[model samples]
Target chain A: MQTTRTTPSRLAKRAHYDEATIHPILDEALFCTVSFAVDGQPMAIPTAFARKGNKLYIHGSVGSHFIRTIENGAPVCISVMLADGLVLAKSAFHHSVNYRSVVIFANAEKVTDEAECMEALALITDHLIPGRWDDLRPTTASEMRKTTVLVFSLAEASAKLRAGGPSDDPDDENRPTWAGVIPLQTVRQTPVPAPYNNDTPLPDYLINPQNT
Target chain B: MQTTRTTPSRLAKRAHYDEATIHPILDEALFCTVSFAVDGQPMAIPTAFARKGNKLYIHGSVGSHFIRTIENGAPVCISVMLADGLVLAKSAFHHSVNYRSVVIFANAEKVTDEAECMEALALITDHLIPGRWDDLRPTTASEMRKTTVLVFSLAEASAKLRAGGPSDDPDDENRPTWAGVIPLQTVRQTPVPAPYNNDTPLPDYLINPQNT
Candidate 1:
């Protein structure tokens, strides 16, 4: 699973297969694009993901063709990206985004066990927002039956990242244009309470992150 | 190409294939995941993207296998997503991210014409930061030769979005829990000037957005 060949030829240094790099990026990103080949043509779909121990879990209803295709053991690629900032270089050729991304090459297998399926659902919800799972109603037996949870191993994966300011050429040092890093952040705003739900105060966990 | 079938079986109302919805999402996102099948195994990659008219352009060096693979005319899927918020519902099953996403299924074609290629390069630059192309050092003929630009039509793409607060089941409406949307925004912070460049004032475009 640890292979240098997974890195693209253009900038191999930016790519790595270390578990230390790939897991953190996967944990930070709750949404990912899952790609699979359908009759020789590739298709990509956005879905929620959660990393439980060493496996990545994605869920969809059994009525969905996407899940059916995966139930048949089709090869899949799950990609997650966190765009940190826009690296503004003096030269257009060197312009890039500072991001931490992971590309996981694996196949999805159905988790038929009821206990594991419930755990996967909780993990998926918790991954999106911590502590929400503890407060929300537990998964019902019928709901679990309707859902098809697919599990994939994180054994074959690689990550790429470029942090810091723009890496411009020394020759362009005198270029008068401002060269810098405009940091981009995904921020959580004040919660908009749902209607009909009487003045239930926002939990401390969600409120705390908004402050920072 | 705009079809209701593009929507997942779970929530059909949140999906659309209209150009109006799809183009704006592609324009706002700085990065995307490109998925293609290699030897029957799907590979997904995160890369920078630019929207020009109806085509999405992605550039890579000639030395990159990703670009060379596109130069061979392979079917590729480009996926872009903007996670806007985290929707917490009374039930864990309904917890989701308010996201705008587009999935493009198309084949990549190399841009052989120099004029078009140069325009694509500039479009890519300006797409990242408005008014950046005119200010930066001009791209040399040698730089053009080393870079390969691939253009893919967005004619067969679709977009799906969920923008509102949590949609809870009628049964769980009375649950004593906070149900709402914590909006997530990708914000731009103050630019950090490159080390070698002495205190260069931030540009007008970057400055204007930061003020808001």
Candidate 2:
């Protein structure tokens, strides 16, 4: 989704609006720590999420305090960060990092329509693992009733990213200090069968990383 | 540090604590997003930090708006998160992540003593990359004048951690779907020499990960 001027805070800088740079980082992240105020107190809760198109969905228990507060139209801040590497610079002040992160500040609303909720659930399932929504049993009505799904339109969002190497000071260039980035990555491993699984064949999707 | 019961909200669940489970994860992490209110508006800033002896030190400009607010004894909520793996569950509701994170809610104060600030800075540098502080040039007086350091005692902190594979529904055990974790790691690579380095030798510390 395009970031508008109204929320310039959400705008992405440095190679701005490169879908190739944004989509993969957002899609690969599984947890987002949401920060918001409750009765004047600020609290952050880590929760699972699913993205569908440009909208991000987070589901929690209907009784969760965070869900209740957001349902009241309280402003919320949701952030997803991928720490790529540590940038060691010659100057302490210049020491930074190489990371890709997206922060969205929006008014969240609970999804009410059953059809929309189902679509959101499917989107979440597929977001977590591709090709799995059709392979497993669908969510029962009872389960959906107990869960509260909140939709955050990626309207006011900004992605601040730093990539490449260290920006050290010229004076310290001759200082015999190590300077480089420790590139970080996330990789899916072999699925661990449930304790009760009776040696069933591994799902084709699990066997093939490309499927995801 | 123990989380007291006076404010029950600060008392995290048992699963959130357990230093054995949380220390290594916290040490590996490089950044923390701190949230607080400024003039009734919420602001989250990403900053470098160092943890030593149950205290986390964050340094910034003395004139920084965030540091100014924190110096005034405003309630601060700091969160450090390390995403170990992405949990892809069978059901959307069950989908989660394997992560270790710590959240601290407390009052912060600016380090006023020059000696203490220097020691704290050393701790911060050592924490970021062990043995680097002694190897690099010391901070100049001008650098010290421009910097402000705030310490957050982890005494009131709560560590929350989740590890291992995904937790799926018992009924979905027989379903031919993939269920597992995608391991995530932060890896440091060879330092890229600055253009002005003119092919200087890489620091021994950077070449030896063990020193870090």
Candidate 3:
């Protein structure tokens, strides 16, 4: 939905409201930054997140300042960004970044029910490594007690995207500068087994994550 | 400068206050998310940033909603995060991401001086492509008029870093699940030239960025 807050006053052409444009950005991102106020001062903290339908979930230690300070129904902003490339232009003013980013404004709610909390935890784990959650040991009661999970509805969200090459002025086309895009991608390197991993073979899911 | 807000209530050991530990993370990140309140609600917007000494600079169109809403001395929280690896553990609760993140709580100040503003623009351009600014066409007066630059001091900044392999509990060590670190890295791919790029050869600076 295009609420007053979601609409941009400038460069309005890049804003997107549909889930088709927003969901991919959120799911592709391994983590997101949550913004909230304390004493009227805004703060942003980065943490892992997962999405189930239209709800996004984030968790932290029960004793975390962020988890404790954020009350139920408090307004928050969540943002996820994926930098795709560097847009090099002939002029300094035209230089830009090729990126896909999403911003959501919503009220945070604590997940207290045991079943919901457990499901969110599993979703988060599987989001990180698809199918790995089913293979892992079950969560213990102590572990559940130490975590604080928060959920936000993606009702008020918008996405902005910038892609392709630089948009330099026509006059600067003959400039000596090299103008093009240098693509950036998040890639997985060789997995390193733990010292006590017992020489278990690497899982195929980790080798090829769901998104990549 | 370990202030009350900079200290993490949990995992205090992961937080660091020295510039030696914080500066590299700031320099390595191409962009940062700035958090500020509008009508007592928090919002986070991501933008390109460049650091000069202890001051961080970000710029946007003068008419942007983010630029207009922010005042000269409004309290803002800026955060930069780089995901290093994924920690896959034997248990769901132990799954975590290895990352280096910094959060700063500071007041924002606008740059009105012509020389400083020009320098900041160049710094930002070069930060994206180290030597590209010097080779590009100079900025025009109109471009300067259209942009708004803001700066923040790093006095109250702190960085939290988590690295290495999974730290699963001893009881779950013998579980059949694979436990290790799946390293993640942002890498540069083949450059894509603009359709009207005039066939300019790629620069060596882009091939090997300073940090890489």
Q: Model 2 shows how many backbone clashes?
A: 7
RMSD of each: 2.0, 3.8, 1.5
Q: Which sections of candidate 3 miss by over 4 Å? A: A208-212, B208-212
* Model 3 chain A: worst 10 consecutive residues (lDDT sum): A203-212
Model 3 per-residue lDDT tens digits across residues B15-131: 999999999998888889999998789999998999998999999998888887775687999999998898988888888889999999998899999999999988888777778
Off by over 4 Å in 1: A210-212, B3-10, B209-212
Q: What is the C-alpha DockQ of each candidate?
A: 0.79, 0.40, 0.85
TM-score of 2: 0.85
lDDT of 2 by residue, A38-117 (tens): 55556677666777667789877777666887786677778778777677666666666677777677778888999988
Q: What is the C-alpha lDDT profile of model 1 across B20-99, one tens digit per residue?
A: 88888998887788888877777777887799778999888988877777667798888888888888888877777788
Task: Tell me the tens digit of each residue's lDDT in model 3 across A1-212.
Answer: 79999997878899999999999888888889999998889988898899988999988898888888774677999999999998988888888899999999998899989999999988888777778888887788999999999989999999999999999898988776788898888877777888879878777776653323
iRMS, all models: 1.3, 3.3, 1.0
- Per-residue lDDT tens digits for candidate 2, residues B109-191, read 77889998988888777677776677667788898998988887776676776777667778776665656666655555445
